[model samples]
Target: MVFRRGSSQSWPGLGGGSGYTASLGMLRAAVLLVSLPWGAQGAACANVSMALGHRGPLPGGRYLSIGDGSVVEFEFPEKSEGIIVISSQYPGQSNGSGANPMLRVTSLDTEVLTIKNVSAITWGNRGGFVVSIHSGLPGQAPLHIQLMDPHETPPVLIEERRDFCIKVLPAEEAPATRGADQVHFSENPILYLLLPLIFVNKCSFGCKVELEVLKGLLQRPQPMLLGLLGQFLVMPFYAFLMAKVFMLPKVLALGLIITCSSPGGGGSYLFSLLLGGDVTLAISMTFISTVAATCLLPLSSAVYSHLLSIHETLHVPISKILGSLLFVAIPIAAGVLIKSKLPKLSQLLLQVIKPFSFVLLLGGLFLAYRMGVFILADVRLPIVLVGLTVPLVGLLVGYCLAICLKLPVAQRRTVSIEVGVQNSLLALAMLQLSLRRLQADYASQAPFIVALSGTSEMLALVIGHFIYSSLCPVP
Candidate 1:
């Protein structure tokens, strides 16, 4: 997985983007029309409703009026699939007054389902729905929604209206096969800079134990925040400048920017431990930088996209973005809570998990390596340039930022390790889900970069740890 810098604004929200509001409106509208009463002439109807969880409260009802004999079209969200429930109360029809109403549902204007004597029932929840129409002929429109009630003599027709807004989610495209022709690979090889992210969290948690042991000997503690900001914000620009200095191709240049810009990974704790540096500071920096990253990463990507002349914009999936906070931040906070509740248990779990986290991390690397082997062969000169730059810059910038922030020699060692590591594994997952082009454009190179990136991070940790340990022995 490669990094795309300054692409955060390209995300739907953040800078006054409308994508969030538009999505919410569609969701609200779908929930509003689940149940409505129709007048005597209202046997036929037009409406939409989403699935509610079993035994959960029903969503609010949406009301829309249609005229008899008029054609009504209902459009469901794109990729929506499931049973749509339809029930009606005729005008002047009192509750519990038995005037049995019947409705039919269908697809392609063909009668597919019939409901006699409507009963209360609800379906699934949280996502899209499958549409079935009853009554009126299916029109030329993309959605297959039509509702009609059987009435005496001339059954009144519901108006087919066009004012309702229904959104169609685009079909997920398969990955692209033209290797060199893909934009992410050939034009900008910068995407491969996300290597260290693969093991950041597990490594940091493991490393934090050591840091907590040595928290008191330091001359100052709070100033570590400045080092973290420098690590995340300052380093990327340095990477960008160096990439340009080397006259790297657009692909390689973009890759360098992404690598430097990414926040420090949890792995920094291990690297700190290896270096015999301040493990506590490393863990704290990792957590702080990651939280900051949710906002900075997207925004930085947005800005970098514009600056680097990368025309293809990427969006941050709001759900995934939100999930990251809960996944990383919440769990760490919970660990702290656990510590507060039962210090012994928390410590025991941390020690047990810390080693296990390493094993798991290694297993993850092994899996990534096996999967990424095919993509490895596809790395061209540009991709290689990115792979090479990340570690080199990570080391240089990691140390430089530590010094600039005036981190004490020992904490500087910790900051250096923290600055260089990243959660590339998570980034890879997001890339695969969010960007189909990653598969299409660089299928061959993508996996290789991922593997290479992870390997590079591991090496950085090893090297940084050894150097720091030699410089500062544990007192």
Candidate 2:
């Protein structure tokens, strides 16, 4: 329904009391043009009778237009150069029950002018504004125009309340202010999760398993060849193929290379026990693989970098790798030695420290989660898709490699898990150290989408452990 105040169908202008009551203020030569953010065109205009001038007689009533809305024209004696403002209001218009009229200039041949801040009565007012129009012709017909709400009775103004006409002029110049906002990207969050995922889990797990098999195999040349094939050939090839298939980014591919290069995980013995694999074999292989990884990881990184178009030197820190080995290996070797000499004390110590590894891993994962998402966002989609596909491929490649080497079924399963799962934590630590040294802006975004890649791997490990236990139930 349409509503307005101070009008009867045949009452003419008699309902409106005086000329001052009906008079719209005239525009003087002293014109001020204000530029609004909404207008791009060079026009300065405002609604003259847009605001409530005074209250009207009728409060709430509806009517339909008898004809096209009345057009009150203003004569600009000079060439008036400015935008035109058009407005409509009903006196005693409260509870915001009146429709905002669609206003336009018939003279300018333009569509209806839009009014801003004319929504519900806020601060007890509804006002609308628009920018200026340049070069308004001299002796123009109407200085102001009002289009009645098409939904209401037309004739523009209610015959009772006073109507208005305004004259506006142009500003000297327009300013260079347009579209100054913020910059955004699509994949920023994904990059944050990549490094930790690639370096921590995959690198660590694979290194441990490969080394375990290598230790026993390396006692003779035949098995040593098998170990070499598993580490360098099968693993690298699988990674490369997965990257290609998944279309990973160069950075993500580089991350995968780093994972493939890192040596054995420190927790192979515990992981083996949990997964029902051979603990002794896992430890021995872990030792052998850790030693070999310092060299192999660098080589693999270099090759993968070249293939992925990454420009880094792909230099694995042998000294750091050795340092890690010493830190981890010395304590374990000492513990084993002490166990042989004093069984009860050694057993007690083992029990006491058994929880330490898990505690450390938990802390590591937490830190990684906080930092990893930032890196993952920078990771490209190609790299992410490729990285996701790698685990499944690694599993298949591991089984094939084991079969080719004539390994027993149980050993093959162990090797396959080892190959598929890696100690990405180690690689991530090294990457962090490297990033620190390089002083690059190496971060992704917040609220990372896949920052829990580490956690996912942990869940996968649990799944693997349960599956293995079910497959090979204890006698």
What is the C-alpha local distance difference test score of each model?
Answer: 0.44, 0.43
- What is candidate 2's local distance difference test score? 0.43
lDDT of 1 by residue, 1-475 (tens): 1112211010011111134533563443344333322320122223232222122222233221222212243333222232233322223211222322222222221211121112222121122222232221111222222333234544343322233222222334544653443333223333233323432444335324443443552445443566556555776676566656655544344444554555555455655655557766765666667667677776776676577655444544446445554555555555555666667766676566545555545655655555554345455665566565565556566677667766678777776666656555344443444344433224234324634674557655666766786798767
**How big is the positional error of residue 80 in model 2, measured in Å on the Cα after superposition?**
44
Q: Where does candidate 2 stray beyond 4 Å?
A: 1-227, 349-363, 377-382, 429-455, 463-473
Q: Candidate 1 at 150: error in angstroms?
A: 82
**How much is the lDDT of residue 113 in candidate 1?**
18
Tens digit of per-residue lDDT, candidate 2, span 309-371: 555444466676776676556555655556566667655654544354455456555555554
Candidate 2 is scored at a TM of: 0.47
At residue 124, candidate 1 shows an lDDT of 19
Best by TM-score: 1
CA lDDT for candidate 1 = 0.44
The window of 10 residues in a row where model 2 has the poorest summed lDDT is 2-11
Candidate 1 wrong stretches, greater than 4 Å: 1-232, 242-256, 338-347, 350-354, 426-451, 454-475
